[model samples]
Target: MTGICIQATHRRGGFDLDVQAGFSDGRVTAILGGSGAGKSTLLRLVAGLESLKTGRIHVGGRTWADAAAGLHLPPQKRSVGYVFQDYALFDHMSVAGNIAFGIKGSRKERGREASRWCERMHLDGLAERTPDTLSGGQRQRVALARALAPDPDILLLDEPFSAIDTHLKRKLTDDLKDVLRDRPRAVLMVTHALEEARTVADDIAVMAGGRVMRLGTASDVTDDPRAHEVAVLTGWRNLLAVGWMSGNRMGGAWGAVDLDHPAPVDAAWIGIRPERIRIESQPGAGLPAIIKSVRDFGPVREAECVLGCGATLTVHKAWDTPLPAPGTRVGLVLPGEHVRPLTEGRAMAAVDRCDARGRQARA
Candidate 1:
């Protein structure tokens, strides 16, 4: 299947976007990063909403941009469906009217297409409602239907679930996965939530400082050494900056630890999910820590522990598990193989070699 290939540079305000990335067809490719990572800029470039200073963009083997040749396609002619973060429905139009607005066809044909999308989006009974009358989820569904009704070659979503309430957000996420499942066009979705990316994307691209740091299949990107930084950005709580202390082992301020594979001394960083930390009543090979605080999160409990050397760690456990009271002493056990060594530095230069290998696998 033909996919999207983009390599471009653009300058906006104080930021500069120097991005080169490819998206696959028939799969959800999630663009993940922090606030200023240029996720939206990448989407705009692909959609022809932003002008390119250099480079080219191709969708399904068709050239939409070529700066050197002075060829630039306008947004309306790009054949791309865009769903904005705010759900951008027309306040003046009914749900059905909104979906049928820009579609090119006879009135009856447009009505049929609108009705089909409304049914697919579970909005059959709400066809006559205006934007103000629908719930947040319903409005988002309407916006999606409007974007897809035109039958574009590619789909672009910019934080599509960011505006909903927490409870409804989960349901919308599941609903979106189902909607995008059988779509024939390529889809690129931008979000900072790692769990959301995991749920909806087959491949992932992690961007920072207007450049893609890593891009590959979800599992491969998440398993990469550089993924430690991505995990931290995604809200991972416990990341230990450890390095090789001996053969097949590493050492952090906490203690000496073993690894499934040896990593370069300069490139090693150990990471352990908070849930993997086990608190033992007896002395063990793990680090000795003092309980600092305990907080409850629905069905789970998180304990903050301070090691003797002053490093803080969060341990996650079931609410029913026996937990140490604040001020009690405890021990921490981290699995050996969980440690990952990443390349040094955060600059784009450091990611070049690693990203080259990553791009090959993804392609």
Candidate 2:
């Protein structure tokens, strides 16, 4: 009742979105998903840009939309601040003007508010500059300052960093993180990057195929993504479809995983992070694999290994470690604690399957 509650459904073309989620005040929730996951649509529904003809949308106990009562507030009427992917800054307006645009008050009051935001966002000297003269990061700060200027009850961000350069993201992320801290509002951010979500959001809601497959604290969702979709979205690059299972041993095309305990009865996939794999020179220490290739990536070294069953596994180690020669035989130790079992029917692994199909068609 003190934050935002959403139970909404919207259909367009062949896709349907049905989401029921709640965000507490002063917490930031990241909607993590790939393209077409309905992340943006959910944001639109919350901002009143999209209609919910049969569901409810509430912000701090204020009903923005209630289809049963045939009530849907327009976007302008809702206390929401939206930052679009493009930033949507008015090119003609100065930085100060943009930040003060949302505040409805006397000229002096608006100026005073704008100056405060400019200082808060570290855009103090650029107040008089137009949007075209600002850097991408500067423009982003401007957008954020504008959105927060009016102090709305809910903040909606759509791909806020998609357009930023990779090198600049770390600082901007820190800045945004600092801005959101202790802010008494429900902030909803949509992003496909797990690092961004984990670093910024208090909670993460994993979305796929138009629904939230998983939602929990950032650590809980990322550390052990139980669903295949959640695993994929949370940076589990190695997922093996189950070929067979008997007791604690589960065999797939990639090899067999011997769990320390009984496997989940409905397990359909096994996932492990590349960094979780340990390579041993002794053959009998663990599963036998042959190093196929090795690549140096400055801080990290990556190796592609093929198991005895011809399934490929990627292993990552520190760059300072001695690299294994290609074609060298090694034992891969997949610690039981790092292995994740993704249950059947709960995950929509359609993204990978569709990609594989497209690759086949292209070939």
Candidate 3:
């Protein structure tokens, strides 16, 4: 019940944005989508950079903006913090100076306050270094420390890890998550990386075409997805257009997937996460498939399978499992419980696709 509520609508040119979501108390809510999905726009509106033309925003019992009431607080008056993607630290200021810049106390008091953040962010040694002399990870740490210097009730981060080197991002993300978890404030982070959102956030909000398409816990959204578009966007590998599905049985490009539970009426697509796919050891136990390709990624092996039922699917297996090479014949099985219907009747028409064998199925 305690956290932030945001509702906004803004239309400019061909793109229109409408989002209604919340950041729960002591949790991180990630806004995930492709470019131009309005993730950054929502943050800007909450920070008072964008005009709130038709919505209300309330955080921790404070009304930041309510367009119907003709009230809007400037960013200076709002108790909020923002960490920009590009680490917008003053080029001339040292690390300590940047942290102290957000403090509102006298010069001496500000210096004392900044020292605490330096210790918290593990920047004690780098406090005297300017941004130009620091590495990408160090620069991001400075940006994070500055954002938290004032102890705002809500924190907004716009892809804070995008600029850091890939080798250093995990450590920096862990450092930032520790601070956010221990403090337990309302946080909204915008990132396009699904791995980042799964690793860093408690709740996930998926945006598409200027609207919030799905909102739920990370596991729930990533596991089933429950929609074709969401499943595809989240990197699901085995989504196929099916002609029809009903209780425990579905007929489509992959023939019939004997599900453990009843599927939703008028199903369009059937999907399973790549990790859930398994290579059957016994002959004739699963679907007959021809291996199309196998890709190795150090720890995991990805295999593309063309099912005898005409549909093609991808399966992920561990590197040590010893997979057959391309063009090998094998039996494939989709674990019944993991395979679920991905779409309702509305999207049935949008996903028509031909299986590998030229049989048409709804995508």
Candidate 4:
């Protein structure tokens, strides 16, 4: 295979992971999901840190793991670079020594390579410092530099930004993006942050409940996540149960929306992104609803509204827009093109409203 192909079933404790995904060279594929969704375990499976109960992993036409062939490569035997969530750097060694440990050359040559990475990772003067003396972002850079020092064929990152401060996350993410731009290798990153996955990855694999829920380009997956679990993970804040009401119309907890065409037969929920919802003050403008509350979030304002069915919907609007006071009557307009139909499944229970934390609550 020209790219990294993985078809693996792994069991660890109470969790079972069965995923099939492919990642192309020179591209970053983010395995995105919430905690306990099996994102990190999938990364470990690729790195040989976890054994596969069944299936195969082929990287660059070489079989790294194959249950059928009874072949499983050790971590050191596979050409892979891994940056753990903790940025596992040697506290006893200087930054230069830690990075040089991975290089296979002699002392002089290793020193020269380590110096090059220090400059590349913007640690030019800090190379002599120990990891304990460095900041979170600095330690992260050192971990990445050390991983890349060996020139591995694959790069694996597990929540690369979890340890960094909120103020420094964007800058560090941008720095990592610049580092991966021209590198010709398959990079698999595991993260729960949707924005980080969208910002740093060329492709995204949505992992949830120990399976790959969706896989495609970042835009494709984020723009039109058709599955219920996929939609919720990708920022679809309002998911209401719907039932056939009339021609071209479907009634749900949030009232009804008139679609251009008939609703899908299998659609059990109507999903709307918080930013896609529009509130109109006119009595008969659209679906009837009452403004419950509004909060300012700097760039945007979040408003909570209640429908006639007693269900609530969250709407995000530009901060500059006129803010509606609490208890005011308003109409919700779910644009046909912006509304998404979510399929029904055994694991997908009907969600009537979003909780205070902006998560769906099953009624």
Per-residue lDDT tens digits for candidate 2, residues 162-281, read 989999998888888999996888899999998899888998889988888877789888887888778889998878888889988888766677887787777888889899988999
Q: TM-score, each model?
A: 0.90, 0.91, 0.89, 0.91
Off by over 4 Å in 4: 245-248, 261-264, 345-363
Model 1 bad stretches (over 4 Å) = 223-228, 243-246, 265-268, 348-363
Better structure of 1 and 4 per TM-score? 4
lDDT of all predictions, in order shown?
0.81, 0.85, 0.79, 0.84
Per-model tally of clashing residue pairs: 0, 0, 2, 0
lDDT of 3 at 213: 72
Per-residue CA lDDT of model 3 for 1-363, tens digit only, reads 357777767767767777666667688878888899888888888898887768778777677888888888999888778999887889799999999988998999999888888887788888888888988888888898899899888899999889988888788778777878865678889999888888888888777777777777888778877877677667787887878766689877566779898888756888887888777745786777889999988998899989876678888888887888888888887888888787742232222122222222311
TM-score: which is higher, 1 or 2?
2
Ordered from best to worst TM-score, the candidate numbers read: 4, 2, 1, 3
| Model 2 ranges off by over 4 Å | 345-363
Q: Model 3's lDDT to the true fold?
A: 0.79
**Residue 322 C-alpha lDDT in model 4:** 88
Worst 10 residues of 1 by lDDT: 352-361
